[model samples]
Target: MALAETILRAVHKHDLVPKLTRALPWISLLFSFASVIWLLMLPIDGNYRKSYISENALMPGQVTSYFRESEWNIVRGYRNELKIFEGAAIDERNAVVEGWLKDIGLKTAYHRLHDPSVQDNMYAILHAARGDDTEAMVLSVPWTTSDGEYNLGGASLAVALARYFNRMSIWSKNIIIVFSEDGHKSLRSWVEAYHTSLDTTAGSIEAAIVLEYGGDSDYFEYYEMHYEGLNGQLPNLDLLNTANLVSYHENIHISIQQTEGEKLTRNDYLTRLKTFLKGIVSLTLAGIVTPSNGCESFSGWQIQAFTIKVKGTSGGNDITQIGRVVDETFRSVNNLLEKFHQSFFFYLMLGPRYFVSIGTYLPSAALIAASFALSSLSCMLNSGFTIPHFLLNISSVLKFFVMIELSSFLLSTFLPYLVKQTTDESDKISLVNLILLSMTSLVNINSKFAFSMISFSLFFIAMVIVALLILNFSLALCIGLLAMPLQFVQQLLNSIEAKIKVFLCLFVSNPFFVVYITGGLYLEAFGYQNGTLNLMTGLLTSWDDVQCWTWFIVMLGWFPAWLSIAISCGLGDFKNQAPVSYIKKNQ
Candidate 1:
């Protein structure tokens, strides 16, 4: 009780007002200090230099490999066959590929993945190894067409890889090569089905490696890999480290490009690229070998998959080289006696090289979000009612909750119908009439302007959402959260016609706006949820993307200008501040 009293006294003694010689709260300073240190330190997490061997057991690029000449011949033959059978349905392609796999001595099983979310068929498999069928690996190739035309050569490569893999006895894990008919959605579904298969006792699979855009028979032009998975999930970091080792050994330009990079820095880029490939391989193994936890199938979760964007003016490594790289990567993964569990998954990559953990960055966003809730609650608390002779404080703060619930219900039930009617050209509704109707629908029975404020706020909120989708999700989340306080503050100022409202807004809005725009962006980019305030946490703990910081400054200055104008109109002059005088002369 004594400690509590002392704390309360300290809080009461320290005022936030200017010109007061008292100490402000230490919490804010602590937060700001932490944010700055984190932002600066994140840039120098330092990427792999020469990709030193993290694991000594696996020796890469040391063995005498001979897939180059023979793989090319097979690739050419498959290409010729595919060219002849072009324009075939996915089923026809799958059938031909299955025949090729069987002929190559690989055990093949096809799964007909039906996705109700978007109707599509995704074919997958379990390729048991020659000796023991204990562990396995996956390789996936999605069909990309040249002018909405399917690239038939992709099937040929999958079949060829299966054949090549079947011939090799060095593989400690069995292989599962999948040919996805649909693109991203289908890949997600196939992974989900594979994970679901583990629930029964029939689980017999291991890691995964997705092959995309592998048609170039010439030098392999592999781009950087994207590793952030669904809801910020990631494959184990050891897989990433092992991949880095392989990239160095193979003398390839591997890069790790995150959402944070504008251009690829060679070393960081290469490490990330190698890491991305390894992630595919490791995730494939995880799906097959680890039961039930590979990919979230029922919940529509997806793996962190990427493609090899082979681009080069001069002809580089051939399909054989790529096959070797894939083979070596699989061999490395097969060397793993356990599932990947040593690396961090929930992390924000400030750059390909740098990252901040979730624990470090979550609080910043939570704090900013809490500010909104606090301000709203404060307004409700202070909105005292007035009677004829006394100030009647009826604490009906719960009314807002009830109103929000009702609004959500109405919007959910009627929004689709309204949208349909709004889009109807035959309805012939005038713009003015539409506006009036929208306004009317928003007006509450008692508090006309109060509800109007909410309605307008929500409408703009939705518009902002649409605009965000059109722009960038991270950008949208920042703008929306930042604008929320301004919208609320604007309404409050308008309600009271308070002269100091502008000053209050400038003081409060500027800082929070910066926090909102800048903070929200980092959070969203780092795969934080779509919360207006959650982004703040990301900003404090994550490396501030310098590009976003520019826009953040612009947003920061916006509210201050309006605030200045409002102040000028309300209290900038003596006349504005003069007390109102009423004179009545009567006989």
Candidate 2:
């Protein structure tokens, strides 16, 4: 026993922990950089394979679609009718849709949702002939797209599909056709109502398909499938694969991430990297921003849903053909014995046909997140080993930590309400100025160890990263990568030059600033003229409507950490001297 103890002591005394602590910052930087590079390389030809339907029940493109030239007249007829309600009031338009649904000999109902905005939605259930009303599928179409353009083609096709499917006797699962007034808000209200039993007539939704059609093109040349859902939730890979397969069999070109008609070259590394980064950015934005489509609302309910947007000009399938795609997809869902379990739920889609599954892509995110953990551990160890009074002062540091975090939480919770209540622009400006003045004057005017608060803040940020990773991996990865520099740069803030660099880094990395910059870039890329203010306002509205935590996490969790770090940098120098000296100097 004494020999064993001696060996253990020798091992412990070999300076291994100190060596690791010394090397951790460099190690974390290398790991973070390498992981991102590795992620960017995943879109290469050999790295990812063509996605296949993992669910055997989803025999995509096997059933021949009978939707032919005969349905084209019906689609055209519906489109003609939609023109009358083009600029009508919401109630008038919804009544027209409800009348059309009733004409199909189906029981229809209208739901009035007021999420600080009044909107009306219509729905009808085509109860299955062969089974109980235990399982159901959703066929949802928004009255307007996110761009506020009328989804004329989509709504017309949906009406036609409802009429066509009403005559079919082969369905074993109920089909609920929904016409939402607005894309995200109305669908979320409906879904929430259904789950909470507010809509007693609604059944359990198994899967959902959102149809979004644009342009006045007679023939649909291609489709864009948006699979990312709320909080980084993804629909089953089989669902996406099935849609791609059906599109291919129907002789329709399929695309994703709005990169329609852009062919990827397998041999070019830069092109592939661009494609990969585009996917990452899309996923990250989807998680951080509001729900882009109605399908995202279903994610909160654990229902697998995605949007299939039809795009084209002249030489492809028409509305009838698009309806057939929906027809075939629902038929496959009707064959499922249970919820989607055979395919990956977490994946990064490279294109309509290719994807990198969680197993292949998650390590990149995990490694980046791990870098923060390593840095935190190293910081704790270095402080404890180098500062003799670290233990004695830690209690006071923790008290300050708690106070800061609490203040941050309170600020985040009340600031939006205050901003919203301030109707006058001048009042809002004055309120902001007063708050800034009060905070600056009262909070840290004579405080010592103010710079040291950054270390504790980093620790808090590390915890937030871990929690966020579990909730939304893409979001966590994005934030984690942005905040990674703090881990390495915090120690170097002792010099003015280093402080300036750190301050700049923190400023650029602030979630609010990041959101503004990214929002501007996204608008520019997509050719939208909307400014950053509108985008930020829309994001905040989404948070209020859907209770999305993306905004809260940034404001309450990340922003406070950033503010502390910035304040620390501005206070002059980080006191990395012995904790005894730090405490004595402050006293």
Candidate 3:
């Protein structure tokens, strides 16, 4: 409270409207930081809910399944056939597969898509059960890339499933078998084409089940379900629930991990970790190449993306069993009457079991980002009217904008070379270091520290005025932002401390230090014991009262924190300034 009074008085003494005026910068910084934190916290995990019939008429998982027995020999024969003709030319493979589908008495037609992004061919179709191909569910099996590789057993199983599906007359929805080329990238494009109104050239598709590898006899340690959809849009809550239910019902020992989850199997972990590193590498090289030549974004499918083949493992579950999982899953999706609308479009999962919704975690990252933006805005507002300094500030802002423009330009140029350099193992550190250096250079060059301080101070004052809002949000956010300046002060002193011992002593003694350390332990308790973190996740799934209130507070609180900080710093000279000193001197 004393600190608040001191800050207000300092702002008031300045020629600028003091008092709460100082709080403006602080508030702005807080809001900007919160926004950035929100973006970063967006969930990227692949766990999707199972699709269910939203409309009353659509009954899913209801049909008496004929797939229980008597089909083991046929499934094995199909699996064996897959090994012999694997990765053969798509046309040759298609001919044989089409013959099999026709023999099973299903009407099939080929849908071709030409993807210009990676230059590949994709083959897909609708398997009409009775006659009319009105509503359809997609069963996608990516064909081999240009290279002759027989690794994607998931695609082979999908093909066999298509043949099996053709024989069944019970399917109410038409099953479209899509043989996507160029891997996941091409599949994304084709699926986009199918759904988009502007790009409706690919025709309409209902729900889609992407089959990755499922042909080998060797069992996987556990069935891995990849659900992180493009851009964080999940399938449906019911879909995820159904998959979990079905996985259990089948008595198949399986553990699921979304693409970014924590409890990942060793192989899954290594595979994704490698992909992340490679992505970073590609981006770094892309940055360098963009300035000199035109470039394109690199594909993980083309690089060290994880490839789990069915032929390698011998223990978990058989090819036939995997086929049934996909079949049952599709049957569940076939029941969907409406598009996915309930679940969150964006989320981050720590593991398959642990997840954070966009709402809760978003604030953490968004707060960070909002802090930057608030600092920038406060910087702009406090920009000294002094002619030379104002001009200097303007020049700096312009220069930073120019750098951003140049980076964008570079990104468009020399993309291929950047991708190659990234994929090359030998060039790792050089690329990573360069990227970091560039980003840091850009951020530092653009930082308006003096103005930012003034902004932070002003925002802090404003927050005090509205103390009533303190209880509206998770206290964690309020405390975090309020302590930012203290954190800054401690860091600054720590940097200049004379000795290691002195620095450690000052750190422990600092006012902010005790709060942070104590708060951290308490936060851990909330996360582990109370389901506090998961409660946030649940809130994010639906637009409930808590999420609405949380968003409001985060948005409102951020700016004030930044503005107050800035204002506080701008008034730093107030302690020595005297009012009406000229009159006193004359007397």
- Give the per-residue Cα lDDT of candidate 2 at 163: 87
Q: Which ten contiguous residues of candidate 1 have the minimum total lDDT?
A: 578-587
Where does model 3 exceed 4 Å of error? 1-64, 107-132, 144-156, 192-203, 253-312, 350-354, 374-407, 410-587
TM-score for all models, in order of appearance: 0.59, 0.89, 0.53
Model 3, span 349-373: residue lDDT tens: 3332334444445345335434544
Clashing pairs in 2: none
**Model 2, residue 68: what's the lDDT?**
73
Model 3 local distance difference test score: 0.42
Question: How would you order the candidates by TM-score, starting with the best?
Answer: 2, 1, 3
Best by TM-score: 2
- Candidate 3 lands at a TM-score of 0.53
How far does residue 16 in candidate 2 sit from its true spot (Å)? 6.9
Output the lDDT of residue 432, model 2: 63
lDDT for 36 (candidate 1): 36
